[model samples]
Target chain A: MKLKLTTLALGAVMAAGPVMADLVFPSLSYRTGPYAAGGIPFADGYADYFTLLNERDGGIGGVMTKLIECETGYNTEKGVECYESTKGEGALVYQPLSTGITYQLIPKVTADNIPLHTMGYGRTSAANGEVFSNVFNYPANYWNGASGVVNYLLESNGGDLKGKKIALVYHNSAYGKEPIRTLEELSAKHGFELMALPVDHPGQEQKSQWLQIRRERPDFVTMWGWGVMNQVAIQEAANIRFPMENFIGVWWSGAEHDVMSAGDAADGYKALTFHNVGRDFPVFHHIQKYVVDTGKAAGAGDQIGTVLYNRGMYAAMLAAEAAKTAQGIHGTADINAAMMRDGMEALEINEAKMADLGMPNFGPSFNVSCENHGGPGLVGVTQWDASSKTWSLISDFKPTDGDVIGALVAEDSGAYAAENKITPNCN
Target chain B: MPDQFLFATEVFINGLMAGVLYALVALGFVLIYKASGIFNYAQGVMALFAAMTLVGIMNGQVPFSHIINAVFGTEIHHFGWHVPAFLAIILTVGVMVGFAWLVQRLVMRHLVGQEPIILFMATIGLAYFLEGVSDLMWGSEIKKLDVGLPQGGSFWIEDMTAGLGSENFYGFFIDNLDMVATIVAALLVVGLVLFSQYTKQGRAMRAVADDHQAALSVGISLNFIWVLVWSVAGFVALVAGIMWGTKSGVQFSLSLIALKALPVLMLGGFTSIPGAIVGGLIIGVGEKMFEFWIGPLVGGATENWFAYVLALLFLVFRPQGLFGEKIIERV
Candidate 1:
């Protein structure tokens, strides 16, 4: 109890003051824990992008964006405390990095009338803006990622997934299990045998899991792992000599930090991604000049080119763009969290906008609508070439089967709305 | 062997391999509990620190870069020279020894006469301190530590065992890293036993374990013995760190494996080395077999808690653990 209170007080100290001049974007960060391998890069990228905006463009719409990182260490309780402490400080939006935290924040943010950008993670049904009201998982969600992985597999096997055996070895938590429903739906739709294998939390010991896979002989293994789990899974996959080509991971498991441990053995491992990897984009040049070269970067500036780093930057860019849109809509420089929520509802990042933002086709361009907070659920596939030690985008961004996923989203969100006595508030 | 039996044998072999890794951690706990009568909860965190330090040294990363960066607003990452694996390990060992000395001087020495529970809590405090220090120093990014340890599955073993199962079963899939770990663990146990049985310092350690008060009466320095055992435990942690760090990249979850060792310690007596080893093997094999056979019926993923449950059951029957001396209540 003392520790919790102390952490809350510490979170208060770290939060941006409830000042009018700065747009406080409280980052629920975890730069010191099990998932720090992932969280550090993401937090760095998120902070650095805001730093870049402040330096390069003088903030979004002439208002300073204070990206105060409240260290939660990926603990859900700490995350909730961080939310409660910082929501008073004009927090424009919340990006609870962990899905577990996102789950906890969804209701809280709704009550607080603040917007949350879960971004490619969190509850897939939260994409239904009509029910969630304040929660947003724009660009893509886990359902999109799952469908994308299946779509890639179907395309790889000449568009027919009949009589195929696919296994999902996922982390046994909310974040890891987020895609089960979608995968199950896709399997039934495509006539594939879906075997769900839940790896225990942290997922280091998977000798028995692979043994079962060896016995069952699943044609393709789709991993939804994170942290040390990713490396361990890759190592175990390599140990089982599961064809690297046949095994794929979600975007969370696709980073260099995960596969580098396996070295050459992880050569042909593929993963589903919504954005392009590498430091070739124009925005990266600006980030290098404005953040890294200026020596004001949060983490090792040289690590700017990794997969998750890019994703983090993309998330920050989206948030900033939403803030800009809110400013434009409200016709005020100092827009509040409510206005920011409105701006998030009106977010649109097309090719022209991406180019204007100095990132030309860096990722799949999508728009968030009033009823659909999740943009056109588009995702691409990337393969890791250990020889070159880089990820290359292998396919065009394909839209998820929204006809199927949309129905599930509506059903799930309807259930949530009924449970919470929340009337659909679409405008 | 029939296909079903062959698969079970394969699972058992994998379990034994995992047990060796667990024993490596529990061995450190037993060493400390025996010598100082303090349950070092920070033992796992010690392994994380050792691995982080080793990786930091090898990569030539600037220590405390996070703090240094936060204070100065500078983005310096590396000193830019890769030290060889052998040299890095040696330097890391030096750091661990220095850490042991520091703990003795600062934390452990102050709480020298504290109750066992108090000392245990202090170690937990030490664990958090070391974790923060490690994160700040290494910059919290997971670094792949490759000390040139052999990895992946052994083709030789796989090919040799192919005919043991049905055509569908493509032999056993044991990690070659696990194989290397088993050999290293065997060597470590032997070295520890030989040193304790033969060397004067080791004899002093054994004496301290026997009775700290009696050893002190017979001209042994309790502080010196405590320091020596801690130093030995640090060495054991480093070896475990290297094995685990190489298997899965050195990250914070590397510390949680210490939790796994707790059940092993409970099943084995806290003061018994051989008991730690046997208890680790039993927990490992038991969990794996249970998960493989009964896990599916209960929705799988049983490896996480099965060991703890088994350990609890073991304690109900044998309170002093399998190889531990029978405990007698003073009342």
Candidate 2:
């Protein structure tokens, strides 16, 4: 009885040990709802990457990182609620992952002095950090994706795309409508006919759109779709016997789930990507050993190399690197949200850094500055091989039409600054 | 023929095919509303659950594996055996039947004499609950549902009709899956009509739907009839799920198809199966035709609201709906 009492007392004391102060990154995830299929793998990826860092590297700069996951169900209102609730938990950065939610949280995060990273999807003008200081969309944006698609087509046609009829079958929402302006500008520059087809939300029925596609027979079809919309569009494209090689989709539309349903017919479907494809990275090996093998995986461990999973892991890596930068800049391991923002603004990702992080050539090297939150806008192209059930990067990370994109970004951000009655300045 | 005219005709045919699918989804609502006064908002979620259950059984996936693994710290995901699609579908039907019985026992029986709004609210609550339960059971990943149904455009029809159009026009592109859905929906409607008109249990169901108190006084068990109606609705939901799941990968969005059926229900009236069909056809063709015609002028994407607007007009003009029984109350 005396020995048992002593053990109990020791166990109680150990169990009630001091809580460690860590860098908090709030992941506004949607693991259930209409978009849950896409959300699950991504959320899993994000959490798993942080877990990898915790297990493998003992966290960034010897300080542990805590990911506070709040379910948003892909709803804007719930996303706001998540932000409001988790913002007080010492969160250093926010990655909402949804454009609708990102748009809502922009002002809120700015007000709270937390850095918001939208990655590839959000307000393109936020790339103009002069107007929107708190928001950052690096490596690529929708305009970059649109320019990439056009660039790939131009390359295929031997640098000439005049008289080519390209159709844009897009989701009828802000996220989908984003590329229209860029494509329209590209059409004027390259002399290609651009037709925009809008598919309603939860795009289950798209017979009419596909039927029109059949009738018109555009030279190439570029889709800006998400979730069920992507699957249905791919299936419909397959059904109409559209040449799979001629069909291209945004990164959001290119995933294993989107084309797997169509079987072999989805072969050769192309999508514009900003990062490398597949599980060839050295970091994945470490992740497998530390995260999956240890049963600390954020998901089923089956999504380790999947596209969205890799994207999520990439996002987490960027956040970690930024945190490391903050630690270096502040001369302290412990960093606050404001310090994180400064670090993000000063962050630079190069080939050497990526190689050191074990994700050599995983993505393009770029620098984020006070004036430019978005990266070099370099994009790559990927092709789906249905038989092998894999996506292979077929094109190198190449520059987009920065002249047109820059002008548009400046114009839009300028208008935004004017409307908000704010002085646009790097200071 | 002019290319524009040929395109319009193609759109009309596709619209008819699309209507068959809409009617298939709405049929479940009509069945439940006819048998009971309660409008089941969970009908779409039922379809999602049924599809996920079917896929899970076919793939030999362990149900609630995510939760089980989380709690036990184990990594058991599958059963190491894949069930044949035919048997898996049968098993799924059995599960849905069990679900119907559970819903009747746990939910409907308690709300027997409740107001219509209360029952409706109960179904809305059931929708969220079933959605969460389905996600927990299936792991919330998009699953491909292939019951060996034919897919892609009908090549024979495309080839045969290509000559009838302008050289630029390829042909009428009709999906083989849509064709299968139409046939299945037709067979289902015929079978339902025959069962309700001929079988003794079906007669009991109709009698109960007519006047629950009167049917109870005449030896018909309200509990059994409600369970039967729910089971039939569950079967309808399964069929709709299979069709839509095959068209699009089975995912959480499968539950939102119920929203599409609402306008169908409002236009068809909640009590008539045939009305559901006609209403579905009208809405489908109207929306498609309107989108094909006036959508471009208005910047396209008119399919979402066109059906609701037409249904609203119907509600204002014909509250009982076409083919619906007109209610008469004596003061």
Candidate 3:
């Protein structure tokens, strides 16, 4: 009893000191693995953005934001370890780029009052406003990405999604399963037939998959793959005489590295673009002027404006915006987790402000709320042109079906909570 | 039922194409195993590295841009010395030869009398080390390897009555590259058979293959034979890499497919050239056919296990393999 009393007294004393002014980030980076092709650039871009913030803006609100990188290597266990290790250092938010890790950490982040930003991945149902309170998949979910691609195909084939056969060749994982629930729903609603093809992980050999495609002859094929698998799928599809324009990839499937692997054959392949593209934007210009030109950039020259880099920059933008909002509420950037949560829900990136911020193609502005974690589901389609070695935006932002997503989010978040054995904080 | 049969035929032809690709990979394994008992597990990695080098050189991503510029009197990013396709192919073959020579000198020479398993483990180590080294050299991003193979199928086989069926059964289409690979593989097989039968060096290699001890006792320099065999294996691996790299764009996972050749070796005799080619074709065609007929019934990923399962069954019936010499040990 005397020892317990002494321990309690020490804890109380420790709690009395002023919390250190720090913004800790739990980086879910995969630097060494198959997915490292995608993961390395993303981590580098995320890290560089934080470093730029510290150097250019004198930190977020004059208090430095510490970017703590704990490599997940794209494994779920390492992601949890990184989260647990960084949460104690006063973590502001967690952005697990992996769907598996996002599902694992949702309950923990919610219970611990740390919001997770799962951009373009994770539980498609998490896009529901009421079901997922602390989790946000802004820009769009997989379903939104799928819808954007389907819509692009519809527009290309004379502007209608009725009575079409859409095939989905996907890696058979949770990441691959994400768009299916939504795509099936869309198929049912729009009178389109959906053919699902599952490719096991590391999708290297896919001749049979392409042969099946040749036999079935689906009107369009959208792929959900990463790393070498993406290139292999494109190559196989090309070999089978599949029309390149009809093949659409998810945001993950659409990278310069992925296209480069297929060379000129992947010229007309289209994919969903959630954020700005090309290095001509003002923010990119700033990065070039301040970071690259001044020798502060972390990546190679050829890697600039790639898919992963833009995703990382967007993630950094969200974090800084949340910090700015938290400063507005708490009157300091060195706010606690609760303040960060509040800031995350209250951010408003208007179109005019986005343009002023040097992002002209920065989709739509959105704001989250206490009950609604995911902001607006807006997406645009982009296509690669091999001759120029650049991606050109082919469509404007189209609003995704939020109602459909809300129902899924409700069903999925409940499933996620139950599977992981956690209570929902819906109350 | 008719549609299913047509689909089955379609799947079979498709499998043959896939088999050709797998055979190309297995040929590399057979060539190395025939020359040296050690299975060069890093053949797939060698292919990936070779393809990466090709793409890197073509795209001006290689360093020495200033030197290339100085030599040509113009600033070039990569080896901006765009030689013709045949020259590029020749240079790649040279690279593989150099790689083989280096490996023979640095790694194989030291493990002369070591256990076979130890050498195999060394190759595995070499595989990972090469993967890391390749990534570091060529930036771990996915790159396109376009050796200017024909893109899509050209000739449309429309005469349905020409086959062993009715008007509904049309001749299947073939990609131009697939046809080229099949032709090239056939030519290489014939060329290699003639070389092994006709040339003195080829006879020396066969002597080495027959029995390393006898070959050594008959005044044959073991080191020279070993290096020669490795160089030949390296040539085979380079050709296999170019074909497969042309097919799949030569990323890191392509090396993983090299592991699939193990089961092929088990089905074919480990040391038989014809066994490797035929075994690769059988495994390839068998897996594709099985996946087509029964894949959807069992979670639709039978492509991953079908080849291994087929080889396992063959092992059950024929313990020494189809072409492997049956062992008769005397105590």
Best candidate (score: DockQ) = 2
Candidate 1 Cα outliers beyond 4 Å, as residue runs: A1-17, B65-81
The 10-residue segment with the lowest total lDDT in model 1 chain B = B320-329
True contacts kept of 2: 0.86
- Candidate 2 CAPRI classification by DockQ: high
Clashing pairs in 1: none
lDDT of 1 by residue, B1-331 (tens): 6888888888999999898899999999999988888989899999999999999999999999767877997767789999999999999889988899899989888987789899999998999999989887886777788998888878888888898777876777777888888888888889999989999989999998887789889999887878888888999999999999888888899998898798899898888889989998998999999988998899889987999999999999998888777757697
User: Model 3: clashing residue pairs?
Assistant: A125-A409, A260-B144, A261-B143, A261-B144, B60-B78, B69-B74
Scored against the native two-chain complex, candidate 2 gets a DockQ of 0.81
True contacts kept of each: 0.85, 0.86, 0.69
Which docking band does candidate 3 fall into?
acceptable
In candidate 3 chain A, what residue range of length 10 has the lowest lDDT sum?
A294-303
Could you tell me how far off, in angstroms, the CA of residue A254 lies in candidate 1 after the best superposition? 0.9
Q: Give the top-scoring candidate (lDDT).
A: 2
Give each model a TM-score: 0.96, 0.97, 0.88
**Model-by-model DockQ, in order:** 0.73, 0.81, 0.48
- Candidate 1 structure, TM-score to reference: 0.96
Which stretches in model 2 have alpha-carbon errors above 4 Å?
A1-20
TM-score, candidate 3, chain B alone: 0.88
